[model samples]
Target: MREDTAQEQGLDLEPPVPMEEEKEVMEEMEVEIEDPLPCLSETDTQGIIKGRDLFGYVGIEAVLDQMRRKTMKAGFEFNIMVVGQSGLGKSTLVNTLFKSKVSRKSCTPNYEEKISKTVHLQSVSHIIEEKGVKMKLTVIDTPGFGDQINNENCWEPIVKYVNEQYEKYLKEELNVNRKRRIPDSRVHCCVYFLPATGHWLRPIDVEFMRRLGKIVSIVPVIAKADTLTLEERLEFKQRIRQDLQANGIRVYPQKEYDEDAEDRILNDKIRENIPFAVVGTDKEHQVNGNKVLGRKTKWGIIEVENVAHCEFAHLRDLLIRSHLQDLKDVTHNIHYETYRVKRLNESNANGLALSPLTLENGTLEKSEAESHL
Candidate 1:
């Protein structure tokens, strides 16, 4: 009688539900939500994640911002080496490259204080900050190169230095406990200054670039290009390329290493204008009421920054603007990989670790490195 009275008062003992509605309520509770980027699936054989339409904000695009923040905080290191004969305006060009006094003038008498009896290696570093990003730029200058009367085997010291860097990196990597980021002192790029002789590649230049090309990224440039006529510059560049091809010298942006069609298209343009005819001057000259870094010649100012006047812009673009990171990549991937593999294979083959150096004339020199095949 009390249950009947409660039911009559509009309170049901059990809330009644329709069969179809009850089944839908149970099904909704049992359903499991899935991720859009499914890692594995019965339908996907190769396990590739295909792009899908996002229903809501997933924050995936924030990864680029995170990477940018980390890189900005860490800054960057770029080490470049300059190799050329004396008085080729190497320092001037390097300074022009950074748009600051990063490189000492080769003309300065203090620089020649030590008459380079042999090819000696030295480095200078500067911290350049641009728009909150700091770049530690180190310029390794090779003086006394080809300065001696007998310039035979002048590249020995440079080779030794490069190998020494590789050895340093290898040792760091082999350490049981290593630094979070090993200091990258390896030569990223070697800008070889070729004299504007309006001629083919010289034997010394060829030899230097060929050997260095294997170990480092080489960017050969015709220095003091203003000295040559426009016609002469074009002919000289053509001849240099021909000689380089005939001699089997590998320069930067090697066709074999092109990453994809985009890289090939961009690098093809650079290859067509290899051995850039470049002039470097840190002097600011008045051109059309504006001061430009250029040389004040009788035939107007040879604007260093002006592409119309010289190809320095092209060289700078390739070096710093367009291919700076690419050069570093090539060094780490191709050049460093070659050195690393050779060293490891030799160590394994010999059944012992090779010493860093062997004595020659009571002076320590780099052990024989495998031929860069």
Candidate 2:
């Protein structure tokens, strides 16, 4: 009937599709409907691409090698400040750690003759190279610290020095034409030595650490641990830890700074063993057909690296191997950032210009810088 109507109207119509062809088209449509193409947007799958998600080799891991090469070419700087009295083996420990005479006392022939009446800051820097890598190691020594009978405000000099370094770096950063690599004299870590008296933390110790801990990373250790018995050492460490808590002093590997679960676990172990009871010696003695770094007493030799004898190994691992980079990062990001923000805010409030004052040597004069502080 439709065909007859179309013929009467002078309209031409095409023939209908066969039943089998129609069925095949329907099957194809069903197949497409069952397995549609993905409709993912960039925002949906934007993060954390897994290895299996990659189609083929992309060579993205080569960035590590590139970074290593650059770092090797441009050596980094690490400045460590050692705070203790003269007879605490601070110089000996530093030399023992690096296997080189990098301390101020080591460099000076008559160091004992030149003891300062007040706290004096001296820094000695040396370029250390090993296995195609170079590092500029600077050891800051605080002489006459805690050495005087009337020890009043001995930490003031140390505090001033730390701020001076921060000021220097901040000045360079604020400069319009800054150096490509601003020399980092900022103290990364301050190793505070406590005498192994087998007693609680003294007032001076608590006060010094309390002030310095806020500005830099402080790692307290029992200097000359061999003087105490094993039980005495453990008890002394416990007492010191309790004192640190009661006094509200924050030491390194602080709980709040843990970055992740893994870091927390590792640092928790270190925290439990805080204020490592360490013995330092530059002399080596023959034991078991091999030479070992140790101090010889009348009874036997006390091995410095042996865990059973002393915790120097743990201290070394923490400072050099495990948390070295973290120390640097904390110095720059946490300590220095805090100082920078405070200084900038003060300048803003005072309506002072951001431009740094400079002396003839293109550096801030010590007196002028400390005046601001």
Best by TM-score: 2
Error of 1 at 245 (Å): 0.1
On lDDT, the candidate that comes out on top is 2
What is candidate 2's lDDT per residue for 1-373, written digit by digit as tens? 9889999999989889999999999988874343233445555664456667777989999999999999999989999999998789999999989988888878987756456799889899999999989999999999899888988788888887898899889988988998999999999999999998998888899999998899999999999999999899999999999999999999998898899999999999999889998988889899999999999999999999999999999999999999999999999999999988877776787676776553122223433454343
lDDT of 1 by residue, 271-352 (tens): 9988888888778877789988988878778888887778889888998899999998998898989988877776687576
| lDDT at residue 123 of model 1 (Cα atoms) | 88
| Model 1: worst 10 consecutive residues (lDDT sum) | 358-367
Candidate 1's displacement at residue 211, Å, is 1.0
| lDDT values for all models | 0.83, 0.88
What C-alpha lDDT does candidate 2 achieve relative to the native structure? 0.88
